[model samples]
Target chain A: MKAAAAARIMPALVWAAAALALWQSGAWLLQQRGVALASSKLPYPYLVAVALFRNAGSLLAEAAVTLLNACEGFLLGAAAGVALALFMSLSATMERIAAPYAVASQMVPILGLAPIVYAIFRDENTARVLIAGYISFFPVALHTLRGLQSVRQEDRDLLHVLACGRAASYRVLRLPAALPGMFTGLKAAAPLAVTGAILVELMGAQRGIGVLMLRHLYYGPTHAALFWCTVLLAAALGIAAYGITAALENTLLPWSRTSGRRQGRGLR
Target chain B: MSMPYSTSSARSGKEASGKVEAERASGVSEHVAVLVTVEATAEGALKGDGEAGAADAARQYGAADPTAEAEAGVELGAAAGAEVGAEASDASAAADDRNRTRTSPKAAPAEKGRFMQQGTAAWALPLGAGLALAAIWQAGLIHAVLGLAAYQLPLPSAIFRAAADNAGLLFRSAGYTLLEAAAGIAAGTLLGWLAAAMAAAMPRWGSGALLLAASLGAVPIVALAPIMNLWLGDGLASRAAVAAAATLAPMAIGSYRGLTSADSASMDLMNVLGAGAVPAFFKLRLPSSLPAMLTAFKISTAGGLIAAMVSEFFYSSRGLGYLLSNSVKIARMPLGWACIGAAAAAGIGMYMLVQAAERRLLLWHPEFRRRLS
Candidate 1:
């Protein structure tokens, strides 16, 4: 590798080493302080590893459920958003009528909404999906609307001249035109779906990553150790989800890279 | 590719052709084209003539009056008359310009039409989708299907009333939370900016420090919160620390990119002038990076709120997050909803404030100009 590439990779290696060193020193410090309120809890790193191994099966099951919920919610919400965007684009009266509701929806946080959804749905899986869908819906709807609205005028004029019907125009013009924006929304909604599932699980749920986290905190051998472990697992899951979505975005909309670069520069 | 259509006399020919085709194919009279144009022009004038143009168009086009078509013609005539008066007064200035230039008068009007076409091009999909959604919602179909679900979701009316009823408590807690967010944002921004500047100016070791800070920033809020609470204690300090930590990475990355991303030409020019490091940074790099820093600040403002709230889950006794957690524990759903409302309002308010500041600071920037236009 070139020196520049090596230089970039060095930071990741250094960060890992530093994190290990920090963990060791933290353990040494805790030992020196003789803070042994929880004798069953191992030292920092050991406890993390043990918790990981011990709960691996349950953790995987919970993670799978949570991931499934998020995926289902994301797909549904994205579809609804695209539908809404298309509807709004077709008629001014509809846009006017939906404007208030759309704005209101964006303002309502999923954290507050999840419990009510849980109460209504009753079924744990349904409730989790509803909350996840609710949380994921706004970004998709908002971004899809924006994306559809951003279609170049020349393209629309050309379609009109072709005497394309509404459905035909949508299929040939708007859908392709809105892809980049749709992807942007999908990327944003990916993390939000996870967050929604987690929040719903936090509120009230029998199983999921969130429930697992709460279980560890409430029923584990030690609060600190278990909390840290749950956090690590959650973070890894979030990062993994984000990475997958980003990869999908690049694969689906290679043309958007130029615009994305422009936006990045323009932001600066 | 070849500017496909001619600019001069393009609209008249296109409109006439479009009308003839409509008459032949759809059996609709050319008068409908005239009517639609008149109505669209009048509505466009009323709506598009100002900042809330789109809203005005929504209102005008959305009205359900029986005489809508006739009213549109009258409105269009009135708008045209007004425009004529403005044009008459500017005729002298136009004459002077005409004397000095060879460009056709039709050229400007054609360009204007082309620009308007562009504006409306992207607007159709959103407008159409919005209308369809309203139709569904208005038919009371959505309410029926999702009504019970909606109740659990809290109808817009319920959420608004809940906000109004707890206005005092919500506002007070929001104020406290906002103070923490603001302080954290300011501190994080300054520290991050400084670190970025140091890294850019002295690339060897400062860059390493920046990388370390960025990685720390990437650490999840859940992991950082308890540790911060343990270190800083369960007070405003802990929440603030978490917020600060959460915000630090974005600001560092944003400002570092801003600083190092300066144009090579500008850098070379500064060097050629024998400008000192500090002077070059301040004169060339810092000003250029101000917009990015503002963007980072806007992002961090939201991050700060999330961090502060999450931290409150573990530490602190008074912020919105604490209130929310407690309310949830007791199942005081309304109050918990109230707390969520307060946090959302605070977050939105902070975001708007940053946006407002961005507009003020970058008034000359093209993005702001496009937004205003």
Candidate 2:
């Protein structure tokens, strides 16, 4: 397992180095031509790295604020999603009533509602959390419902033959079976929740990495490297959310490792 | 052949979702094509059952064969669990024995159609529920319950009226945003596919490249949008660049999975026939990868549009996202809601188009073929 992980990490390191080289050269070429705000357009990788190291303390504080709200929202949304799925699973009629909209909601650009949500709440933290929850609610519900529905007729009968009650069937068979799908939903939602928090911040929030980004952005070329630092921090926050969820999934549902690896549920 | 979920030879009418889940999780994608195809297939079956009086069939069958329900449950579990490997075949065999005696050939099509329709008719109740919710919202019940004012949460009628009033602008803005989305998706998909192809050809470095792409998926569009604007300026190029960046990762990961996931038995066969790598890839891997590719396309389609809109919120002079953010800033709640509705409509419309493309392209795939059977 250690060797396999190393094998995976080796190429990623190489790829990252290659990407940095490409970016540095591209920035250099642009600067050579003296394009307008050349450094701002594509800052040197080393300069951006320097900015990142310098701003680490403040950046970490702001990132923590955004991360906290995102975590709160992710938990809220996930609980609601699982509850809805379980409720819908109680009867075919319930499933019929809720499932389509759940699916349709996925098709809708839920992120586009971010600004509207921020406007309505008029509180950055509340709006951030609400949008995150709202954005995550549908995927979790849909995937969880799909997981619940995937319960086989025969296993259900075996439980019935053993005189298992509805609660027992769910506890012993259905819930465990739903884990793989539920994790899929959770992993998908984590990054979006962070994105939601950052998006709300971008929409005139008082604090968080996004506010810093916009602040630095307004200053233009002088703050180019700093702006790039904020952007990278936002990206890192999202990736961290995804990584943490993925790690949790690995630990909690080790059985689903192969299944999880099989499909990449794309981000919205 | 790592067919994680076995395709039951005697798929009962009620097993459409089970089938959909297995197919989706086994490989390919979770959203997009699976649900859309299952929707049409379910509707076809549901319309038939609706004509036959569903309760009557339930009543008769519920009494006549208790095991029938049990057997259906088994099939559902077998498909849903993603059990994989050897046990998959065993479950399928058991499912075969249980279901074979139930769905006779003569009644198979109608019953199959009914269950599938069960999937489609599932939409009906949701529609009714939506209408009820809309009516309640329209009546100001939601506003009252939430302690919100009408200005904060406009009535559906007001939103509709706003939509009608600004139809021309909304229409044009939607077109502009959609153009950016489509162009970006096209470019991103092509680039991603090429990247996947390159990775597939070079096994040593390919996994890392794919990993890079997957991590790229985690980066927020908000981050990408500004950088794109900075580099490309506040034009179509910036928004489209954001959309492309947003979409690139999914297609790369998906197509890579598809290309590499070709069963070893096929590879062995190609080797025995003295087939070259290019020939084998074109003949075997590419064709097999279509479902995954199409699934990625579906995801990228929706994602690209959303990414484009999100980027527009940053700097665009027009487009639904710009109009939406602009209206909300000025407290034009009704117009904002209208833009939201239009963007949602456009999203669903594009998703449907991708689903149509999936149907056209994937007729030979086992999952789609089962829809016919």
Candidate 3:
């Protein structure tokens, strides 16, 4: 089983290694050809490592700021979305009256929404959080609504028979039943929060990986390694947020885990 | 445990209020379920084309019809609806009371699954809710609470006036952004399908290859935007590239799922016929993947539009995104609001177009056909 898991991972690891080597050599070739921005945009992979090591302090600081926004926005958005979905599930009228508009509002791109928000707040950081929260909340609400509504009638009825009361039913049946769907929303929201933070940062910011990336962009070819380093840092933050949520889903929702149980019991 | 639980029963305590409120979830289990399903359809309708075909498949199939197995216990569900309806919210509670007073006497308990009869027509309440919300915004209720000024929260009338004033510019920008989204979606879906095909055809390295592609979903549009802008320059191509990148993961994941999701029974039959992997894919998997691909399209459609718009945040001269941002910078709140309205129109237009195409193409699929008469 371990061997099979390793085999599954091997190709991607190999592909990534090959891509990295190609990138390093390709940049070298581009430099030989005197192509502009090659070293800056596509720096040698080793130089990126060095830049990471050198700028560890500043990069960490900026990454912390950006990640903080993503995390906070994620928490707030998920809460708000859950609340909205609760309202949605509470009454047929609310679901009927609200769902279409909720769906419509989400369809309008958050990027379009961001500028209007930025205009309102006039504080870049505040706007950044709102942008992140805005992007994160929709998926949470959608998935939560879907999750809550999708709760099995038997389970709900069981609680009714048990005289477990509504709160207990919600606690035991609805919320837990909704976990998988909520996870789906959380998964979608995480990376988007990162994107939102980076985006609003483009408009203006004093700190965050977004600001750092922008600063590094115009830093000329001389600071090429740092720019790529900043990009890597930003990418890592998003992946980390996504990965954390995915890990939480895996841990908390054991019934949904496809690989661990199915392939495990003496299959090999 | 029973004593403590009963003491806190909002569900049990509902009758104690001495006010007659309709049980939201009644013996008409199908009615409430229909409300959720129709609303789900409408929700999926707002996203890009064909996505709901897959999502709703999982939803509807997984949620087996409750009334079938629980016909005896179904009547016991009278307490369940009241439980949720009883949750703390003065607004919805009041609203639910009004609904019960008007209709509880005549609302039929149909044994037959004719959900379209009385249940679906209740859209009026929500529509009224929408109007009431707009009225609140127009009356500055939000501004009063939030303490934000007119500049921050433009009234609907002001936004409408602004939209009428700048009709030409707003429409042009919306068209421009929509074009980029359309082109990007086409390119990205094609690329993604090819990648999925490559992975599915070769299971040896398929999982790894698919994983790498799926991980691209983790790469946000913002991170891709400035780099694409740098590589392609600040033109339509850059936004398109960003859109393509944004959409690629969903398409790849969806197509891969569709390609591989062919029933094991059909797969074994193919194996019996001595069909090679590539032939099996074309003969069985490709056709099977349509719903998934459509679902991916639905998911990616909204993604592509947002991607294109986000890409334009830094380095573009045209599109609703740029105009929206520019208007905000200049303190033109109404113009910015107009841009949002135009963007909404474009989004709704895209969703409808995709849904129509999905219905046309997937007429044979039971899920899509359910919406047909």
Candidate 4:
């Protein structure tokens, strides 16, 4: 247990070490190239860390806006996904009909759609949420559909033999079996929703981490350390999002976690 | 030839998702030789109802067969567990998994044409829906309903006209973007594979490295766009770099899973035979990894395109994203729509291309073989 804990901590150390090495090498390369002017544009890792610590409050505020947008979108998308999955599962024909569209929806670039959606909604937060919801829903829908269909024939037979109605069978048997699958969908959606939120924020958003990152970038030549610090915060949020869902899955669906193990539910 | 255990002569109407479920249950990959062996054993279990050697399948997946766990290291143990469950369930529907690939999805869309009393009618449903959707947009129904202007939802005809008028330019831009995507994916995939391979050799730090890389992938592309632009400048290199960065994580994660899927029993045998790690990798690990690698490639196709387009949002003078964003900025809604159309077509085109290649290349594997039979 202790070893595993230490092992868990090692990646961060390695990542930090890597960052330092890259910074030194980059600094060295710039010096060799006589690009002293450009050297200030790529800050040392420590400087970025200091900058991050200094601006933590503003960054946290921005993150709150982005997270809220993503969370609302996540719920909306997950609900839509569940509804679609339930609707599709009742009829194999619907599942088939909707499958291609699901694939096509995924195929359409959400980045391009973000601007168009922004134009339509004209509300920054709504547009960001819309794109987040669009991206988040796909994984959930596919996984939920997979879970619903994964009901064993014999288990389904037992429900039939018990004279269980379609709704009852779905509620009692199918949903239980699909919980793990749904969790898989949720986990995949977390980071994706954040990415979507950020992408949409780029189009036009007065607030949010996306805007902050772009703002950092726009002023990067002057504030290189601040930009890197913002990037680090975004990375931390993604990791946090991933960790949260994974933790939730472990806590909520222990049975599915143990039993299905791989069931390969993640799409992204 | 690997045993065709799933070649159940009885192809009937029991078109369940048994196969898809099984594959999905397993890590959505496994066209390599090792999976072929697994399928063979499972096939025997189903065909003879346990008369065939279940021991073989059992042994292959046992603690000794280290390759069973050779997949995305993070999910490797889970995948192995899932495979065992799938193996149990798949024995009954081994034939179904194959059969569905060959048939079901293809017949789905036409269902809404009528009552879908027959499966074949399902094909037209999606196509019809798309055409009808196009018709609605063309008729200004969405514009009227949504209270939107012509600029927001350009008519299909106007977009088509723009496409035709600038067909040559659109085509050229698409080719340029596609080339950049292809180059990026190729470079990224290679780098990812190498990283995964290096990591696979050292189970401790390697997996962590991979995890870090993957999490880095979750960093917003919008954030990376400007930085990448600053670093690589406004050349094709910047766009390609963005695409590469975007695609690298998936490839690394996938290939790591593939590379590590080396069977320990085989490795033991190689040890006895005095074969070096290099020889064993070439003989055993590489073939087993082909499925995961292919799966990764298939996934990267559309993603790579999206990455390229997103990167184009920042800098560079070419590609569909540049055109789309530029046209939209200039209020040439039709032209922007045309760019969106070309970009979507390119993305879909690449996705289909990769899928087709997977089917073609892995034809001998049960997943693809079911379609052929």
Best by TM-score: 2
Error of 3 at B255 (Å): 3.4
Residue B124 CA displacement from its true place in model 2, Å = 3.6
lDDT of 1 by residue, B1-373 (tens): 1122222222333334323322333322222222222323433553322212212222333434434433433443344322322212122122212111333433443454456555565456556775676576556566678556443444445556777887887777778877777777778878888878877776654566676656456455655665665566677777787788868866875687667657789999999999999999998898777765775676567767877776676566787877787777775666777777677667767766877788888787543454344
lDDT of 1 by residue, A1-268 (tens): 3665566556556656787788777777767777653322325687677878887887778878888987887788778877887777677556655644554455455555665666666687887777667756765675676566656667778989999988887888778877866775665567656766777787668887777676666654455566666666766665455557766766666666313233222111
* Interface DockQ of candidate 2: 0.23
Off by over 4 Å in 1: A1-7, A35-43, A72-107, A126-192, A220-224, A248-268, B1-143, B147-165, B188-227, B245-296, B310-316, B325-336
Each model's lDDT: 0.61, 0.71, 0.68, 0.67
Model 1 collision count: 20
User: Taking the tens digit of each residue's C-alpha lDDT, what string does model 2 give over B1-373?
Assistant: 1011112322342444234333423433222122212222344343232222222222322434444433433333233223323322323233333233344323443444466556456557777888999999999888887778888888999999999999999999999999999989988898788878878887557766765665666677888887787778788988988888778876886687678668789999999999999999999999987866776676677778889998888788899889988887798989988888888788878877877788888887764564333
- What is the C-alpha lDDT profile of model 3 across B1-373, one tens digit per residue? 1122212332333433345234432343334332222322332232111122222222333334433323212212222232222121222232233223333313422311244333435566766877899999998888888778887778999999999999999888988999999989888888788778877776656555565565666676776777787678888888888888778777886687667668789999999999998888888999887865775676678788888876776688899989987887788989887887787677767776877787777888643443232
Model with the higher DockQ, candidate 2 or 3: 2
lDDT tens readout by residue for model 4, A1-268: 6665666567657866886798878866876787745645466666777888998899999988888898888888989988888888887668757866776677677876877787787788888888888878877886677577767777888999999999899889999987866776676567778888878877668998878888767764677778787777777777677677777776677565322124322212
DockQ of each: 0.11, 0.23, 0.21, 0.21
For residue A191, give model 3's deviation from the true position in Å: 1.0
> What fraction of correct interface contacts does each candidate retain?
0.13, 0.45, 0.39, 0.39
Superposed on all Cα atoms, model 1 deviates from the true structure by an RMSD in Å of 12.7
Error of 1 at B43 (Å): 22
